[model samples]
Target: MSAPDVVFVTGNANKLKEVKMILASESSKINLINEPLDLEEIQDVDLQSIALAKCKQASKLLGPGRPVFVEDTALCFDSFNGLPGAYIKWFVKSMGLAGIVQMLSGFENKGAEAITTLTYTDGEGHFHTFQGVTHGTIVTSRGPTDFGWDSIFQPDESHGQTYAEMDKAAKNAISHRGRAFAEFKAFIATEFK
Candidate 1:
């Protein structure tokens, strides 16, 4: 058997690097291509829909015969009733993480969750969507080892430490991306082979 042909379509450098690193294990049997697909990020919506839209856009750009993967993720806070669930990017830019932390201060509810929806589309326009979610809580302050919302978002009862408090490898090991990729790997292994 030969390696399957696929391309990863994303414009986020950080996310692209992360996904490529996670998928590197399949290099022996998969041709993983990374292409920056230009897609406008829509405002205030569930990430699943956003991910699907991104995959569709990439599929149109690539035409048919190859598979392209796209993912959109958001951090939802329980204290705010998921106010930032789909508006994370905008909030991150305008309010900054510190501002968000402050905004959630003095709340009895600091529970939070990271949700990721992976949209995988074959070249012919067929799509397979998978989701990965990690339940955690929001911390009063920041931690020293993670990025994005990791500094303040602690996994539920995570021994009083936020994701930022954990090492990169440790965090990635159980992250939303990790869960999603694991499922993607299994799916491809079973169905594509």
Candidate 2:
């Protein structure tokens, strides 16, 4: 039997690389393909809803019978009551990493959660969602500042290291995306095979 092909709708190279790495670590048999689409994302505080919408749009564009998936990630701060749950992208864009740290400077509770919602569509309107969350705290930038919010957000499991500070393998081992993909890989094993 040949590996199943699944389309991953994303334009971000970092995301693609990380997903590929995670999947490869599991020795996934799925032939993941990157289909970058400029789908208009709906404005919603719910990560699943946003991801589902993107998956639906991608399915429509890819047409019938093609398996496709889309992902949406969020960084929700405990002190802010998840104010930036589904708007982390915009927040990072406007505030920058330093600004984000500054925004939390007044708050002693820097606790936050990094969330990843992976929505998959079978191109027939059937959608399934997998979510993974990693709890952490907001700190001063400590690593590579290239990726969004990676330098300031440190996972709870990490020994005081930011995502950008950890190696690819180390980061993927406990990342929100990794956890979400773990669920996704299981789904593919059962559903596709």
Candidate 3:
């Protein structure tokens, strides 16, 4: 038997890269294919709802009985009451990394949570949602500035290095995306097999 093909609906190259790395590490049998769709996401504070909506839309577009998945990531600050939960992308776009960190400068609490939600539709009207969260702090940007919010958020698990500073293996081991994919990979193992 060949590996099953699963459509991953995302446009962000960094996300795609990370997911691929995570999957490859465990020698996952699922074949992940990227379908970059400009699907409209529901504006909501709930990360699962946002990801589920996107996944459903992708399933419809791709036709019936086709397995597809969508991912939504959030960086929620403790002081902001998660002001930028599902809206982190927009905040990053409008404010940049420095501006986002500045928003927390006045507050004594620099605590934040990095979350990733992966919603999958088996195209059988059944949906599976997996979430992973990492407790961390928002600090001055360090390491490479290429990926989204990687340089600024330091995972508590890491000694002091940010996501960008860690190598691919190290980062994936502790990253929210990595944690989420761990659940996803297990699901694929049983469901797809």
Candidate 4:
């Protein structure tokens, strides 16, 4: 097998797929093991800490000798003073994208930001951290191709299109995950390759 020092641990399949795709070209020399790590989710006020917690859990589950990576993203709307930053997932499920749009319809300001924090741990227990942020605005209307909250959230100066409106390749090129994983890939290249 290729260099067996890389493992991506996540339970979100869609997120995992996108991440693997992003890393594929850069990680050809390494064995990219994809596995869902079982970890209990706890209440936290920040994305960095949550990602680290997940990474730690995965490393421990992997028996102290396997490297694992984890990522968590939070959507912060300036209009809401980042009300749903760390609680994005919960809010999305409870309020849905449409509800969020409706809730923000009256506000003149639609500014927002998406933040992703990534945490990685080598089998030796050494850790690495990275973060990426994309600033945007909340659109009053949903887009046709957008999934999740992408339909209702528009990036700043994005030439007028929601993330869901962009093609996968285009979205990947400028997404929060993409930005963060770019740093992550670089880290792996420098450290593992």
| Best lDDT among the predictions, by candidate number | 3
Tens-place lDDT per residue, model 1, 1-193, is 8788788876677777777777778776678888887887666557777888888888888887778888878888877777788677777789877788877778877777788789898777678988878888766556652346777777764566677786656666677777788888887776566
lDDT of 1 at 154: 79
Model 2 residue 174 lDDT?
Answer: 90
Runs in model 3 lying further than 4 Å from the true structure: 25-28
Could you tell me how far off, in angstroms, the CA of residue 82 lies in candidate 1 after the best superposition?
2.1
After superposition, the stretches of candidate 4 with alpha carbons farther than 4 Å from their true spots are 144-146
Q: RMSDs, each prediction?
A: 2.2, 1.3, 1.1, 1.9
After superposition, the stretches of candidate 2 with alpha carbons farther than 4 Å from their true spots are 25-28
Candidate 1 TM-score, C-alpha based: 0.88
Which 10-residue span in candidate 4 carries the lowest summed lDDT?
Answer: 140-149
In model 3, what is the error at residue 52, expressed in angstroms?
0.6
**Candidate 4, residue 150: how far the Cα is off, in Å:** 1.8
Candidate 4 per-residue lDDT, tens place, 125-165, comes to 78989998888988755566324577877777467788878
Top-scoring candidate (TM-score): 3
What ordering of candidates by lDDT runs from best to worst?
3, 2, 4, 1
lDDT of candidate 2 over 1-193, digit per residue (tens): 8777789999999999889888884445678899999999899988888998899889988989899999999999999999788898998999898888899888989999999999998766789999999999999999798888889989999998999999989998899999999898898778866
Give, for candidate 3, the lowest lDDT window spanning 10 residues.
23-32
